[model samples]
Target: MKTFSAKAEEVEHDWYVVDAEGKALGRLASEIAFRLRGKHKPEYTPHVDTGDYIVVVNAEKIGVTGNKEKDKMYHRHTGYIGSLKSVPLGKLRETHPERIIETAVKGMLPKNTLGRNMYKKMKVFVGPEHTHQAQQPKTLDI
Candidate 1:
């Protein structure tokens, strides 16, 4: 038995849809991270990028437990002598709902090129409507 490695191949990929409405942010991100890393597939290869596409809908409705929405902060710097910026989770959700989920899942993934590739497969939308209807994505029960 050979273990699967993280490599890019020309195999067919499936598309899955997840509704983020009323779902916990961390829980949803874990499931998406699993699928994105191809852990749910029978032919899962640690060194191969065999993940499927994930569409997250209603991102604005995703919830965070406790007071994270207010206390949680995302920070970034502009590469300057004292250029630091931080945004609260609650504000980010209102301004950019998709980013909340994206950030959570991205953080849970491996920090490497393979992880970046997997991150690209995740598509998050603020509302229930999305432009990926042509792919015929199946609803994921997460």
Candidate 2:
């Protein structure tokens, strides 16, 4: 018996649409990361970009438990000294809802070039409307 390893050129990427309304942040992100990494496929190859494209909608309605809404802080630093900046999850939702899911899923992916390529396959929208209708993505229930 021989082990099967999928190749990048031989892999077929499928498009899937997910509704984020009322879904838990962490759980949803993990699921999205799973699909993005192509783990759901039988021919998954870790070294290859075998993930499928994911379209996430209703990002503004994603849910979080406990005090995460206010207590969970996202931090960033500027190039200049003393330029650290932070924002609460609640505030970030109001300003950039799409980033909420994006950040969560990003953290779950591999921290390398392969991960960045997989991350690019995900598309997030604040509302139900997305521009990927042309691809006829199937609805993915998480």
Candidate 3:
């Protein structure tokens, strides 16, 4: 018996589409994260980029339980002093709904170069329509 390690050139990437309408925010993010990391595949290799492209549609319709829309806050800071700023989920959704899913999935992925590479393959759309129809991505149920 021998252990198999996947190589970058040997890995195959596929495109998948997921509808976020009526789906729990956290659950959807986790599933997308898994697919992005290729953890569900048999040839998953931690050091290689084995993930597939995931197109997330209807990002504006994603759901969050309780009062998260108001309670959840996104924060950022400038290099200077007293430059911290925060935005609530509700405000963020109104301004950039796509960012909600992007931030969630980003938090679930590894904080490194490989993670950023995989994250680039994840496409998010505010509406049901996407521009990747040419890729013929299969529907991914979550």
Model number with the top TM-score: 2
Q: What is the C-alpha lDDT of each candidate?
A: 0.90, 0.96, 0.97
Write model 2 residue lDDT over 1-142, tens digit each, in one string: 9999987899999999999999999999999999999999999998998989999999999999999999999998988999999999999999999998999999999999999999999999989999999999999989
Q: C-alpha displacement of 77 in model 2, angstroms?
A: 0.6
Q: Candidate 1, which segments miss by more than 4 Å at Cα?
A: 1-7
The order of the candidates by TM-score, greatest first, is 2, 3, 1
Comparing 2 and 3 on lDDT, the stronger one: 3
Highest lDDT scorer: 3
In angstroms, how far off is 102's CA in candidate 2?
0.6
- Model 2 spans > 4 angstroms off: none
Candidate 1 residue 94 Cα shift, in angstroms, is 1.3
lDDT of 1 by residue, 9-124 (tens): 55457999999999998888998999998888877877788889999999999988899989999998999989999999999988998989989999999999989989999999
